[model samples]
Target: MKDKIRIGCGAGFSGDRLDPAVVLVKDGKLDYLVLECLAERTIALAQKRKLQNPAWGYDPLLERRIESLLELLLEQKVKLITNMGAANPLSAADKVIEIAKRKNLSVRVAAVVGDDVLAKLDVAALSLETKQPLSSHGKIVSANAYLGADGILEALKTNADIIITGRVADPSLFIAPMLHELGWAENDFDRMGKGTVLGHLLECAGQVTGGYYADPGKKHVPDMVNLGHPFVDVFADGSGLLGKVNGTGGVINLDTAKEQLLYEVVNPHAYYTPDVIADFTSVKLMQQAKDRVRVTGGSGTTKPDTLKVSVGYQAGYLGEGEITYAGGNAVGRAKLAGEIVRERLRHTFNEIKVDLMGLNAVHGNALHSTEPYEVRLRVAAKTPDAALAARVGEEVEALYTNGPGGGGGVRKYVHEMIGIVSCLMDRNLIKPEVIIKSI
Candidate 1:
């Protein structure tokens, strides 16, 4: 096995930019490039898309990403692993193969499947969030179990240039490479935990690289427009140095690394994943250089016997409208506009929210003291009936002539909202398979 492997994150989520990935492929000298593009709701939306069209469930940008990077991936011999497959790995693999054929490049792509556990899901299981029966969540569109590194490691054994998966844990995409490249044992909890730390740090692509850490004048990230993605050089023991592309716009200092460490972590002592219950509390981060941080000291025990399954169901529909009011008493006008909408819809819709964008959209009444010269009135409501949902925006648009004066830039939107919840499933129930397609 090699002494160390270099892995870089290309895209953090669905619709992330492609230019940063191109830079990594050309100059990052990475053995693996992971594009973690799947989120809980993202997969649910993909399922909805699949219901509409059989061939369109995967990441919408999959074709463009494959077309853009397939040539460089082949030239650089950098293997790719991504959860961009979303709801359809088989179709995603086919798309990649088609892209390779069009470009006259010979490559083998692997699609990891079997994550969908909807048929096997027990509706009697309790929801981890609401503590209610899964059956009570309404119609479940998708139920996917979080697969670990096993499926990916199996794909690596085939030497596939790209491995696409559906609903695997975010960190598993990065951790699998470490297991395969370093020849780490599957049951090696300590090593797995360390690898998980590395994976979590790099999973968000640019978060640890200063993208999410930027706060003008306070946290002050330089050249925010051209922020670069991050890469880690991981040793067999799981310790690694995290950094970004040389001369890139982002910084990888201790402060940025620490923030990412605690991100979305409910408990640092028992951070759960498909592979292991990583203990981030034990992790040590030290600035080794200008933009390099040495990470080590992560450990863990055996992984959970049950895997988390994200259940997506038809939540209802969200109707939203925004109208901007400027000049004197703009906040007052916006507030009045919101009050009108709320008064009109309050009896019809149970979940109605009205906010003044520049004043109390985020903090609500907590920051109502600020009186801005210009403010946008936003009114939203959730309802089961699409017609009723449509009325919410209609009422806001009517404010142009009916309710408030000086109200302009009316924007309205209505869409079906997917609700996500989690339940635990036995590990033995999930059987991940790898299907390889080649041009």
Candidate 2:
């Protein structure tokens, strides 16, 4: 919107650290760059880490990756927005500020909050389908309400170099600037829809460009290790550029882009958003050939009344240990051995929970309904202490005491102890209230 603004977006797992998407945006003289870090499991993992160590829960993988990207941004002087904060954006932003201060970069960091309504979570207000609060449930491991794009717009107004957010809607990241630069008001539904669609397409950088998808017709998209992220070059009227890193290892073919569009979205025409229900059917993807696609004609409709929420909690702990089998009744023996172990444990203790994962319908009824010649026993337990979780692991091998065919010949399997919690959120509470904050 600002003359010619270029934006880049990327998707990467936290286990490894490298973001080429942001790198390309900086090098290409883009105005904005965004990255997504939180996944379905990210919240639980963040909480688990917090439970272990309060100041140590959030993943620093993205922060480290930002270090490299920030260096380039500093060199080229480009601003970026990212929701890399796994659980707490304020804390995460503070840490990044410290890093910047040490290097004397003079980068301003602001965190967008008010979306997380965990303290006042009530299941009575939730819609179940929306996952917000309409009622009350006493136990909630994690509740993160999605903030809309306006807050990021407010942050950008302050002209900060970097915006670190806790949990904002994926589409909002790309839509914020369009609202800010163009002076677009709340009634600009059509432009808003276009921004939303653009955001969704670029949310998972490599996926749309054939990182995970491999078309038999295209041989260039297969080995995408150094995959680049996604970004859009936006105009004041609500259209932009869709491309990747110049030399990254991904493709942006039309087929792959369409596949990513269908990834997890329910209704393409009625794609709901807090700001507006963007209609992607109007979106025209012009295949620019290898690793490039031109997206246009995306339109929008009225904004929805509710917001989206992400809820997480402990689902109970499970431990699994498997022993090999090479006999005629290997499957039968494994089942019997599992039953014997369960009986012995229940007799010894009352509240230990056990389930046969590999041997039963745990995997899928279609995989092995009648049982196989050889199978694995996956056992688990939930109790007051780690000892109980470990006890199941210790006692399962004793099944061999029943005799070689009856229970013996039971080679010891690897032992595992698991601790799990149950997590659910009210559908009503999932909708977040968008509030813009500035430095």
Candidate 3:
């Protein structure tokens, strides 16, 4: 077993920059490069696209990212782990193979499947909020369980160069590689907890590296425009160093790491995961250098019996339109324009959100200045019927010459919003399957 392994995070979410991965591969000489690309709703959107085209459900930029980082990844001999395969890891693996073939580079890509439980799950699955069954909502789009490091370890056993998964837990992308490289036992709860803590710290890529922590004068980051990706040099004992790329803008400090540790974490004493229950309450973050933090003291308990499932459903059709009014009497004109549109769509839409964009949109009348120079009249609605939703924008457009004057740069949008509901399920039923394919 290796004494230490260096893992770099390329992309934190679905639309993260591809340049950071390139920078890491070109300079870091890392052992593994993981890209956590899937969010809860991304799979539903991918499923929507898949319904239109059977072959396309993965991340839209998967091919572009792979092509951009292929040469560097090959030269650095860095294994890739990513959840870019949103709703379709197999198709994404095939796409990777195609890219490798086009470039005449030999690569083995693995796809971890079985997270999708839409077919097996009942419509009566209770939502986390109201405890209402999923059937009580609109049409359900997708249901996926958060898979853990099991599939990743299975895939790595096949000696794959890259691993792609659908709906795996964010931290598993990093933890799986660590397990494989360190040859750690599956039941090592303490080490697993430590590894999970490390994974959580780096899962968001830029968050712990000062990218998301910057608050202008309060936490100013140098060269914030070109913020660097983060990498961890972790040992089998669960101790590690957190730092960013050399010569890149961004700081890795105790404050940033601590802030990230508390992100999305409800109970610091018991952080639930598919694999193990990690405890970050006792973990310590110490600054090892100018842009490096040493992490230690993480512990883990037995795994949760149930896995968290994210259910995506069609909430309703959303229609929105906006028009800007400037110069003399801008706020008055904007308010009138908003009222006009609101009045027009009153009968058509079930619920509407009408606002004078700059003046009373976000905080309403709670925090605002009177007599603004310019304001935007924004009208939005949620309707059961797409036609009614489409009409909201049309009604706003009709106000051009009929109701409001000096309304410029009018924009409208109609979309079918996918909403999410969460529930827990028996972990045994949603086992992950990993398969490696050659290119």
Q: If scored against the real structure, what TM-score would every candidate get?
A: 0.98, 0.77, 0.95
* Candidate 1 residue runs with Cα over 4 Å from true position: none
Model 3: ten consecutive residues of lowest lDDT = 342-351
Window of ten residues with lowest summed lDDT in model 2: 414-423
Better of 1 and 2 by lDDT: 1
Against the true structure, candidate 2 has what lDDT?
0.65
Ranking by lDDT: 1, 3, 2
RMSD of each: 1.1, 5.3, 1.7
* Model 3 local distance difference test score: 0.88
Q: How are the candidates ranked when ordered by TM-score, highest leading?
A: 1, 3, 2
lDDT of 1 by residue, 197-315 (tens): 99999999989989878887799888878888999999998999998888778899999999998888998999899999999988999999988999999998989999999999998
The local distance difference test score of each candidate is: 0.91, 0.65, 0.88
Model 1, residue 130: distance off in Å is 0.5
- lDDT, candidate 3, 20-99, per-residue tens: 88888888779999998988899999999888898999999999999998877878899999999999999999999999
**Model 1 steric clash pairs:** none
C-alpha RMSD between model 2 and the true structure:
5.3
